[model samples]
Target: MTLTLPPAPHGGPRAGRHLVDAALWPDVARLPRASALRTAVARRIVERAVRRLPLRVRTPGAAAPALPRQPRGSADGLPTLILHDPGAFFRRIGADGLIGFGESYMAGEWDGDDLVGVLTVLAGHVDDLVPQALRRLRGAWVHRRPASDRNTVDGARRNVHRHYDLSNELFATFLDPTLTYSSAVFASLPAGAEDLSAAQHRKIDRLLDLAGTGPGTTLLEIGTGWGELAVRAARRGARVRTVTLSREQRDLALRRVAEAGLRDRVTVELCDYRRVDGTYDAVVSVEMIEAVGAAYWPAYFGALHRLLAPGGRAVLQAITMPHERMLHTARTHTWISKYVFPGGLVPSREAIARHSAAAGLSLVHDTGYGEHYAETLRLWRERFLGRSAEVSALGFDHVFRRMWELYLAYSEAGFRSRYLDVRQLVLTGRTTADRGTG
Candidate 1:
């Protein structure tokens, strides 16, 4: 049955009052009798659906809040948040559906007196979002695809370009000066003193320490973002080779290396890690595995193993989910695969261990710093928002800014809530008898 909403309310005073009128009785006075009957049926269905949730409607405060104008069809079963400027709310809902609600906040479409409080309430009631959860599961099943060659090189490049190549200026405005585009390690910070640059340095130092890096050592970096780690390694007297698919990253990293007079000791290549063949004293990949896709984990680990010298160690840092016997529901996975990070899936610890073991690598040390990542992202978001004007001037439009903001904030929330984790694993390819710590 078709559903019809009431005519948009008049502008100016009493505009808030008309929200109820439009939501309850959208204009259908002149419609045919059959059409009117269908509208009524749809309205009843919507009303019943809304009633099923524990929503607490509040009066408009200073702003004429918008309610969900779209008909609460089966696809719109998720709960909605009433907001000031209901027109903006309708626009978001129409544009992105349930996801739009969160996106709108990132876009600054609506603001609450207490955003954190509202989020807490919504998070507390997440269990009531069963229908949305089911939709996610259904999406996973109906949209499975094989991880083919196109998915790895070209497809992955396109995805990276869409997000990372937006502009180096934009990234530098928010990211730490080092421009290390990965999770940071904040091990030695007093409660709130964890700065991005400091944390990134700690991560680099941790990797170097784990690999037993020293002068004359050869270090290989997979997925070099802006080449900060390579430069740092070279500064410590180690020759470094880094590989990345992002053209922007390679060009900028190489320029930085040259500027530092480390061109002879450091090289950044626009290449895939699988194609890279070399034996190095140490290897590292920071936040690169997400794009490798779960099916390719074994190949990725094997590639790292081959690149490392006997008794040499490799340090890897990536985001992960808690152990799950099965992958995420289709709907959630598809959203990430489509809108966020195409060909990306966060592997569990068990999955990582199994894959590494199959690749002839033994985990020597493992650390979880998921909470530090949350703090890192939060700092990035604050910096990004603080420099919004500069970012916009750097050619980021509304949609692009919104996408980045949502990506940063949601990632922070995921880590903070423990729904996501960041892990650093030190692996050695030597046998137990050789290293004695297999």
Candidate 2:
């Protein structure tokens, strides 16, 4: 059955005042004394971050935005700050810290002339922006990834639905023609030395190469993202079985596969990785592990280990964070986990190695390109803003649009600041990695 989407309320239920009332303002109104204290401590650190940030501020075209205490500076590449409700902005941050900061944008409290540049500065100093002593208190003030969002087959379905199933049209407004959702590895940058679709193809081909996929190979793809990779694999004469829990994605992917004339070779189905039984020459998952909650890391990797044929490689494209940061932030649920991706966690390289090793997989090769992600985000944000009207036409409202604007900027900043990274890792059995490939 094809699912029909209702038009967005301005931008949809995920946006507008409903979102603020349901998610943001509650965090505001219910700032307990304990949380406020933490927010206060957080404020001290953020104030320091702001003071030391190499930022330049100026009136927009000799006219400042309708806000007070705006900083004035020259034409350096620094981001220009614009504030609407300074007190509410700080209050939001005081209560929820990072989540509040993003909510402030959604609530029209502040903005930047160059949102990405401003966020990049903040993301760069994120580690230092919060006092070290606060790590001990994080457990006291933060909400953990909700138990309901767990990666049990049923739980995973709900979590994935919250984000991916929102509306394909919503995503279509931003993503390039390929409908590929992961980071695109570009070759160069001048006037489009590499476009998004091209970069996506490069990223997929590189992973397939790592897996040694070839004509007549049997391949298992853990996450079927709109079917681009599966289509490409089938085009190479590889038989592919790709699984996803997202009904919306599965339906569209099936259509795209058939449209490309590869239905015989590529099979897209709705299935859980744990229940999937197969032995394949190659296995690949792209940026799917983030959605795999921390508790399920063992099963997630073990499935790969069990599925790979002798000497067969598994290539996974995953987003990673610093080891220490990962540990510090792992137990705490922040804005991204709550709003963007429920039950999602970005693992550190150390965590990935530790868990994969425990699950009988060994990492043989790995590559990271955070800057490429930043570039990709920059393009997506620009494209979305360009199509802002079209997005509204799809039923998204003002609040939803601004929320996404901040979401994109927040992510771009993470990569620019070196706070986050994306990597493709080639793995095999420890024994296989130790021996030369046959």
Candidate 3:
């Protein structure tokens, strides 16, 4: 699987610089062909990658026809889009790999016209190249373990630390000031009309609306990031209690609550949701269900149901996939699970509905806002890129910057393309009185 860099078209030093890196150079130098033949092999690998993508993905729009030839020419004299040092990188990512490719991107061993697009293409056609069924079996075997309080708590903290603990300063560079880390809700708004901040505000408003929050109501938020919703609900006259695993989030959220003069009405706890025990008029969990593994969905939902008063309503915003079970070789899922969000798994809509029902909660309303999430990620990506220097200054090197960029952009594409979806579900206990349904 060795691949050597073809000599630059004109034998220029700059052209061969990418291949000179120690990590990749050995494989390139030992490639079993002359430079011309190696170039052809590289083109073939790229073509194979393209072919692995689903047909619809390869041709995103009707106007964009499928590329029939490899090494499509570039008018600007740029290098052809080939996986230089593919063998080395691929070997590094061998057998149940996801984070390695992201690291390689950071190391400048690969280049793409569009990294997000490349990921989307890869994800769409992932089944073609990978043994998905066997991979899932192996992953399940590897992850199978008796559940324990320590394991659950550790998993929760690991996820929180991976994403939320990346440094509040760095997060502020991309996320809105409110720091709502979940999907945003865009209601009655024109497509692409609202910015990330506005969209998140709308999402908070929507959650409050779903919960019927108002004067004299007591609300509880699980996995409350930055406490924006808690503060907002409290301002609306509802007493809010929020739980979070990230110390950073709890600290910032508490400060925000104090600054807003709602400290009396809002309380942020640095603890796992499973440890919290209280009844509220409304209970909301945003973007946290994914961290509750599929094996624990029943218990997770039951906890949510128990936290709500008999007549209380609960709203949840979570990412959902189309499959009945989790995919194994899903590179995006794998990447997030390993590097971005440890122990995260996107449940399918059926799984959520069934689990809610099993927990004595009726799904009164379910709305798909997957595209809005795509839009939200796009805004975050742009903002992150705009603040690249600031992010780099926060102890993140070039590789870290590329990782975050790829994360934001490819996430956006996944949501937009319907490969991933976000759903806001309004659940009410069976004993709850029916309110005006939306």
Candidate 4:
């Protein structure tokens, strides 16, 4: 059923807050508190960032010339961000730095033909934008992670549903035919190389290879992302059993499995990793650990340890942040947690290694591919905009549309700036003393 909502006011003070979808209101209400002192501090931060921004930013190979930063209008055919109300945008940032930055976008305070590109510049200079002295204040603004958003068995279901269950069609419109949502392994992202589906296949193949999955192999997948991994593993003659908390994903994955005539070899169960039973020769989890709250890190890795057979190997693809940043922001509920992925906490490499050691597992090999993830998001964002009409036909309002765009750009910028990284790790139990290559 299509949900029809009165058009949200595009320009006004606080109208955006009132206009955010009902489910998101709770998060908006929690936006950082306003204060004269904080506003003063924010002013300094904003000024520093703005000053550090390159006045002349070049867009290589573009059809137009370099763009002026924060121009009132397009400069020489190149895109420029026009801040309709500079005061309001700055004030929101003053009130709540990160949250306000996103809300300002939702409120239509800024725009450009290349939103992602503009954000990319800012992301590249994130370190210079904020002074080291002021970084300590980040933890001072204490907003505890919501208890209800914990990754307990029951909490996990609600959090997973909040995003994945929106509509398979919604994801389908943006994804390639493979329906893979995570990063693709593009060996060489030439202008006209193999399409995204082929890259996705390569990525899945890498994970399968890392897990040593093959004929008669019993594979246990901790996250069932539309059954792509399971299908690929089964094609290698591995018996696959994948678990997921998403009902929507499970339903469609089962259908896809049956459609491929691998239903007999593959099992798609509506299950949580913490409660998964039995063991397998290989275990694989892709970008699922981010959703496991920090509090459950031990339990999550322990589950992997217990489930892996003695000679079996495990492959995990995780999104990671810097250890210091992770510790500082782990407890805060940011725009991502509130609007897109609830109860999610990205782990740092240090955290992962520590947890794995605790779980009696060794990180034998690891590889980093942050740039590939940025490209993946860039393609998805372009595809999303190309299918805007279809998206609206699915009942998403304008505010919802802007929110998704910002979410995609935000993630892309993080990777482009080296603020975020994605890793593929191979793990094995450390039975005799210890062993690790990473």
Ten consecutive residues with minimal summed lDDT in candidate 1?
Answer: 24-33
Mind giving the per-residue lDDT tens digits that candidate 2 earns over 1-438? 111111112322211333354453454333223354654565465555555556543322244322222346634456756554444555566666677777667766567988888888777767676667775665554666677777788989999998898888989999999999888888875327567898989988998888888899999999898999999999888999999999999999999999999989999999999999967888999999999988899999989988888778889999999998887677777888877888888999999999999988878999998888888988899999999999989977777788788889888899888899999999886345544352
lDDT of 3 by residue, 1-438 (tens): 222233322422222335434443343222222244433433444445444333211211123334433334423322123344444344334422444455545445456666566666565545554444444444421222223312276766876676788798998998888887777766544445656677788888988998999999999998878889998899899998999888888899999999999989998998777788878899989888887877678878988888888788989998988773354422234555655666667888888888999988899998887877877777788889999999978978665676678778768777765778998889988464543321
Model 1, runs deviating above 4 Å: 1-128, 131-137, 140-150, 187-195, 329-333, 431-438
Model 4: residues >4 Å from true position, as ranges?
1-33, 55-80, 139-142, 430-438
* Tens-digit lDDT track of model 4 for 1-438: 111112223443453555666574444433445675776676566545554454332222233332335545544543245454444555667766677777777766556567776677676776677789977877544456778898888999999999999999999888999899899888785425569998899899999999998999999999898998899999999999999988999999999999999988999999889889887889999999999988899999999988887767889999999998898668687768878899999899999999999988899999999988988988899899899899999998767788899999889888887889999999997342332321
Each candidate's lDDT (Cα)? Answer: 0.66, 0.78, 0.68, 0.79
What shift in Å separates residue 339 of candidate 2 from its native position after superposition? 0.2
TM-score of each: 0.74, 0.86, 0.78, 0.86
lDDT of 3: 0.68
What order do you get sorting by lDDT, best first?
4, 2, 3, 1
TM-score of 2: 0.86
**Model 1 Cα shift for residue 373 (angstroms):** 0.9
Which tens-of-lDDT digit does each residue in 1-438 have in candidate 1?
222233224442222223223332222111112233333333343333344543322325533223334435534333334344444444434333345455445444454443333343344444453355444443322334434313466777776776677678888988999998787877654327756788889888888888777799999999899988898889889999999888888889989999999999998888888889878989988888878877678889989888888778899987887664226422243434545677677788888899999999889899988777777877788899899999989866655665577667667756665767888889999643554342
Better of 3 and 4 by lDDT: 4
Of the two candidates 1 and 4, the one with more favorable TM-score, higher being better, is 4
